[model samples]
Target: MSGMGSKMLELDDEDELKDFRACFVDDRSGVNYLDGNSLGRLSRAARDSIMTAIDQEWGVELIRGWEHWGELSFAIGDTLAAELLGAASGQVVVADSTSVNLYKVIMAAHSLVPDRRVLLADLNDFPTDRYILEGIAKANRMELRFIATAMDEPVVADDFAPYLDDDVAVVVLSQVNYRSGALNDLAQIAYTVHSVGAMLVGDLSHSVGAVPIALDDDDIDFAVGCTYKYLNGGPGSPAFLYARRRLQAELTQPIWGWFSARDQFTMAPGYEPVAGIGRFLVGTPPVLQLRALEGALTVVCEAGIERLRAKSLRQTELAIELFEQVLAPHGFRLASPRLGPERGGHVSFEHPHAQELTSILLRDHRVLVDYRAPNRVRFAPSPLYTSFAQVYEGIMALAKAVES
Candidate 1:
């Protein structure tokens, strides 16, 4: 469609990750998928894993599967931590939805500082995160302070310095901005929050798997993230949370289900929470979905997170180049960070008719991208399976969509 397509083909031929495309189910015959930031494509490993979990684990083992199924949460979480998140083994656990985990962490943070009356957060965070924090603030009669951030720029640690005070109990921030694909400095923000006698809770939904995160090294008090997007854990897959080892003894979440009890099958009269990260669990684990995630994680582990991040940066660089050369002339402005490390895996553009343009791309050009409110179209080039050629074709189709 454009002369840049040949250059993309050359780049693809030289890519060490060219073979990774075969690892996932290639259902897009005539389409170019650019929405991995929203939901990743299904992988062949995940498909086989789900079938095995159902047919073999469930069908054959029956009740005995509980012996293994019960431990999948921590087991999978440990694997994620080792492979992706830079945290120790027992500090993380795969559990409820991101929203639910956020609720638990927010409540726990508030309990830690009962005297504090304010909870701070980013005004432009994901809607679900803001809703959970708002509910927590309303329930506890605490002041919810939102730090206003520029829509087109990234949120830096300096933005929160003025908002920090002794009255602030917790500061919640996303590692990567969902709308602009801007990466925030987690370590600096965490340090700033702790300086004010407040705890920091990070939302890693966009950054996990797309980039490297050192939760333990950063001294993050609490964190929560979904697996469906960058982790490629299928739709509605279980989320995970992290709590520092030192805080485990003091942190008590709102929900106290049997799974989080000291002895799950003891049926004790009083509830005694477990002493580790497992205490964050609320109820029964999703075995089928977890199996799918387990399988998906294998692919990520095999590919290695560092290598995947390198490819992600390169792919996004290509996308940005195309945006400047082609889409910029058509009234599209770069919404994501122009620099490589300052951005996440996705690239977003602000356009007047972004919503309509997204629909037209999908319906006519078979190029899939997601639209955010007002006017932003996001294109996530997942490193695990997305290719430079695909990125090239998607941008060409997007340019044609704008023209038509």
Candidate 2:
């Protein structure tokens, strides 16, 4: 290792949270892991919890497993709200995929503002987001408005200001922009949307466990996110939904599922929406998938989101420093914001050879980071499992990759 790289490792050794790194099993030894923003390391808690559920709950109980399976969604949802979501229990539910949840809330939010014929969105927001709104508009025969742009930059706060009128149904955006890691000022934007009588929705896919969020305090009408990232719930884990309490009664969902009926098991002939956020649920939920997230949340709540966030900031700061000190000379322009508060738990940098460089680092250097289109590399500091040493080692490997 270079003298600077060795010092970065020593800097990590002095950290108090360094010992927590051993809690995860790693076959990618001699590699640096910086991909936690995309997928987090499986925690020992998740591993043990899943095994116990399989062996004791499902294996032994079998048909009698309905009791444990039923409350798993709400139970986990309660913990997420109390610890991470910053809302009351009934406000959040682990159900369906993110796209499904987004569709449910988008249509329902429109219903609340009947005359609103336009849907405003970021042209550069995640592709799925833009596509979803387009589909919504096509279904309703409305216009999809893009934020005004000049000099090739995206629409900022001013662009949103002009569009905030009663005619707009819902304004959708990412809480933390996916590709750029730019954090939108949610509370301010939420207030703005409400002032103009529009519902505000955020896709927290990149922010939820990576940063602190308060859906209730912000008076956000709706929100959705994938759990596979920082939640470490494993691939295809159940995504979560949040519908503000005040709007719960006014909004009606598109899908009418048995689990969401007033008396779900009565075999009711007609659809009567159940009270509270449960009405948003559709179809029979996958208990097995919910169980994985349940186990993961156990670890997350135990550690406290506040502590995790603090460590996350430190880790990202260190990674950026190492890049500026070591990799910047080799040809990497910081893609993520330098101001910590404005960015999420991840950092991205531009490298002309990013795609091929990622392949070389993963195959030869054992350093793990992901590449987006064009020329960008994203490094996530998943506080629950990532450590300062990994950041130091990963960047040093990147510096080597740049040379090779």
Q: Give per-residue CA lDDT, model 2, range 193-306, as digits (tens).
A: 888888988899989887899998888889999998989888888889999888899887988898889988889899999999889888878777787787777777766778
- lDDT of each structure? 0.90, 0.82
Q: Candidate 1: lDDT over CA atoms? A: 0.90
lDDT by residue (tens digit), candidate 1, 141-200: 889999999855778778998988899999999999999999998999988899989999
What TM-score quantifies how close candidate 2 is to the native fold? Answer: 0.94
Alpha carbon deviation, residue 145, candidate 1 (Å): 0.1
Model 1 earns a TM-score of 0.98
Whole-structure CA lDDT of model 2: 0.82
